[model samples]
Target: MFSGLFLLAGLALLLINYVVVNETVPDGTGIVSEVVSGEAGAPPPEMYDQVVPAPRDSGQFTTKVARTAVETFRTSTMRQLLIASGIALVGAAAIAALLGWLTARRALRPVHTITATARRLGAESLDRRINLDGPQDELKELADTFDGMLDRLAAAFEGQRRFVANASHELRTPLAVQRTLIEVAMADPTASPELLRLGQHLLHTNERSERLIEGLLVLARSDQGLVSQGPVRLDEVVASVLRSTGGMAAEQGVTVVSRLEPRLVFGDQVLLERLVTNLVHNALHHNEPGGSVVVEVGDQPALTVTNTGAVVPADVVPGLFEPFRRLDRSRRAGRDGAGLGLSIVRSVTRAHRGVVSAEPNLGGGLRITVHLPGLHRALSPASAPAETLGV
Candidate 1:
């Protein structure tokens, strides 16, 4: 289409030049005056008026020379105009192309802002808004609308988090009081055996409820992102957890192994420890009678835990990280897990700006890996130890 328009422009310029050359240049220089011509408005010749006479060949020769000169001058002027037209046509096209590119870039600048805001958005980052500033046009309107949506989302999430944290804290006090009362009642001098058994049952239930509440509070906090960070020795955290849980591993006949590497990560130490503890507990709890749990701590991936258990389908593994999820409904996630082990692990890992994944082990088990931003710090050989339990 543009080519046709350019063709028409070129044709128009040529036609205009041709018409101008012919019509405006005076074709024969008005008969090439050889004798003096009478001035216009001078009286018309009377019936007896006398006129000057000239040689006929002389007049013809002057007229021919004038006609040739006019033709030559017309050719030279037309050639110069055509050359100028060609140069103007090419330069105009180049300028138009450059202007078109600049206009397109300016028009799409708002889209880049939208893309960057989208990339940064997350469950914890709902406060971020595009808030693009420009004219009251489509892109500006779109940005305002996006910012409004983020405002609503931030309010909603804040309310939800407050409710969960408050509800969890409020519930803990009652549970603690109930446990104290149950213990005090069972301490009576003549309490029946049945009463003692009932008290024990009630206490167990109360403890489970407390654990669930605690998990909820922690999950809510983690969803809000980290509050503070410091260099934490992740390997030492793992070693300490292994030592404390060694007796449980022996009791369950589940061998525990750990190859801890020296690594330092900047995060909340308490949350990181909770993250490792949950993984270790789940690994030990969800295994077969003779199953084994292997823990590895290192850089890059940060930590990995593999355990033998029932053959978990690949599809079912993802749900295991969700709250109140387990492989089998009848099965429990360790004695105190309350089905929130992996869920808490996931939240804590995310709070530290990391990623987690689970894969069904080929040999009837599950392997979970957590990747956190960290560095490996070299230490003496004896400072890092490989530990094995229940062998």
Candidate 2:
């Protein structure tokens, strides 16, 4: 396209030069003198002949001489014009290309910003906005529309979170009442064998209901976002959880092993403890009679728990963190779990701004890892008091 423009410019210059050469430079100088010879009061023909040379060889020689001079002038002028035009064309093309590149980059700046903003926006970060500033062009309008959509999404998620929290809190009262009634019925001295069995089953059902409610409450709370941002010693949290669950692990005949390092993180101490407890409990609950559970604490503020259990398919590992997701239907039928342990683990981890992943062991087990943001300073029992370290 540039080449075509350059060619057209050169041709136009040549055509203009042709017209100027013909109009400005006389075609035959001898003819002009003869035409004025017969004019009134004009000099006599002989007088004019003396001043201007007589027409020679039917004036063809003079015409040829004039034509040669015109051709020479046109050729030289057109050569200079061609050189100038070529330079101008090259410079114009370069400038246009540069300007075009810059213009395109500038035009797409808002799109890049939009992409970045979208990537950053998530369940926990819906409050962010594009807030673009510029003229009321198409890009600016697009940014405004995006910001509006985000506002709506933030409102919707906020509403859903609130509803879950409120509903969970409301369910706790009735669940407590049911547990109290079931316990009272079980304590009756005159109850028959069949009645006692029924009462025991009711009691068990009530207990499971209570656990489910508690799990739901914890989940809602975690999803509500972190309320406390305090330094939490992960090693201490793990130690405390181990002590609390020692009896349960003993009943299951599962050995609990640990490699605790003094790793400090910033989050709610209770939630962090819950996260560790859920992982440890899950490991213990799902293991074989002689299986062992290994817990590791490292400087990455990371916690890993691995346990020998029934063979778990690799395909099912990803769904373990989802709510009400269980690996085996038999486990659910056996009343082994409420299927909320790993789900709560994930929720609390996210609330603490951490990440959790799970992978199946080679033989028959599961390994779950949680990585949290670590504090810069190294924490040790001697460096700080127990309470200050959230132990």
Candidate 3:
């Protein structure tokens, strides 16, 4: 700004100087000629140029004085104008620059606040939100967006915390039970048949542990989105799970019934089969003797497992599918299974872009509904329905 002012001032001064030189040099030369002619006494030619002349040098002196005064006033006025214009220009430029800087800072104040707030946020502080206090502008919108992101982060963090806690508790229960069993068996002296039974219990505990570990690995992989998805037959998976669980259901005095349609869906075949198996096993394990377990598979690739036993308590239904969540402590106490069965089922269903919900059956027990995405409309419909086991 200062440089620009100096350049303009210099140009104006040069122009003023040019005008002054052009006016003054001609008048000075004329005055010198007059003085020289008067001193040489060249018969001040009365008739030589003009008709009339200034009388007795009085008018000439007066005229010279007036001209000198006028010229002096002009020179002084020009000097004053240049000085005043230069001062005004410099002052204006300084004021404008200061005002511009202040305005820019004021405009960007919200941006600075946003940067500082974001810098203070981290994984542990994902719940922190920004305070947008200024006018409603783009900055305010940006703050709103940032706040929304923080909300999502907080929810995700909470979910992860819950999952870890539940997983740890579930994994610890079976080991604790096995330890107690071993301690009891060691304390018994005539532990012949008792010790043999303890060995069998330990073996069952080991199997439960193995199953828990395998389920955990599958869930972990599903969470990481490691499984491949394609068109698969839901009826086939259901039938396989039924065949696998047939013996267990029979031993429990539970009758397994099925009503299935040949439905196709896009999903991982292994995970889908596991999901069906877990649901059937959960239903049969919770049912009473002579109770019937009903399994239904539809064209939408939805499965409903209904068992006749004790009705599920209303309060526990909300979290029934969460890990380490069990409504019947008696049922879970002696069992070596980690209570992640339903949790794994829920996880697998979700991984396949599906939903699982449990509700109390009208008569006595619980009914679980698993909904999965079916194949595209372009595929031809299946011709036959398939039935499977109860467990």
lDDT values of the candidates?
0.79, 0.77, 0.72
Ranking the candidates on TM-score from highest down gives 1, 2, 3
Q: Candidate 3 lDDT, tens digit per residue, 1-391?
A: 5456555766687578657755664342354345435652432242223212435556555445434544555566667766776777677667766776688788888888888889876544565788788678898999989889889877986777677558767876777777677767766787788676777778666667767776776666555432367888887788778878899988998889888777788878888888888888888878899899988888553888888998777778878777877877667544526777788888888777788888898788888888888875554465445444433
* Strongest candidate by TM-score: 1
Clashes of each: 0, 0, 1
What are the runs in model 2 whose C-alpha is more than 4 Å off?
Answer: 1-94, 112-125, 220-228, 332-335, 351-353, 381-391
lDDT of 2 by residue, 1-391 (tens): 4445655675677568656755664433443344444333443353354323637545554445444444555567667866776677677667766776688788899999999999887676788999999999999999999999999988988888888768776887787888788778778897788988887888787778878878887887788677667888888888889878888888888888788878889988988888888898899888998788888888663899989988999999999899988888666533556888999999998887789999999978999999899888945545222221111
* Model 3 TM-score, 2 decimals: 0.51
Model 1 per-residue lDDT at 264 = 86
Instruction: Candidate 1: list runs displaced more than 4 Å.
Output: 1-94, 121-131, 332-336, 375-383
Q: Residue-wise lDDT of candidate 1 within 1-391, one digit each (tens)? A: 3445655676687678767765675443452342224332332132012221325456555445555555566677778877787777677766666676688678989989998998898766787889888899999998898899889888988888779768876888899899999999999989999999999999888888888888888888787777667899899899889988988898889999898878888888989998998998888877878889999988768899999987889999889889988678865433746788889999999888899999999988889999999854556455466778875
Model 3 — which ten-residue stretch has the worst lDDT?
Answer: 43-52
Top-lDDT candidate index: 1
**Poorest 10 consecutive residues by lDDT, candidate 1:** 43-52
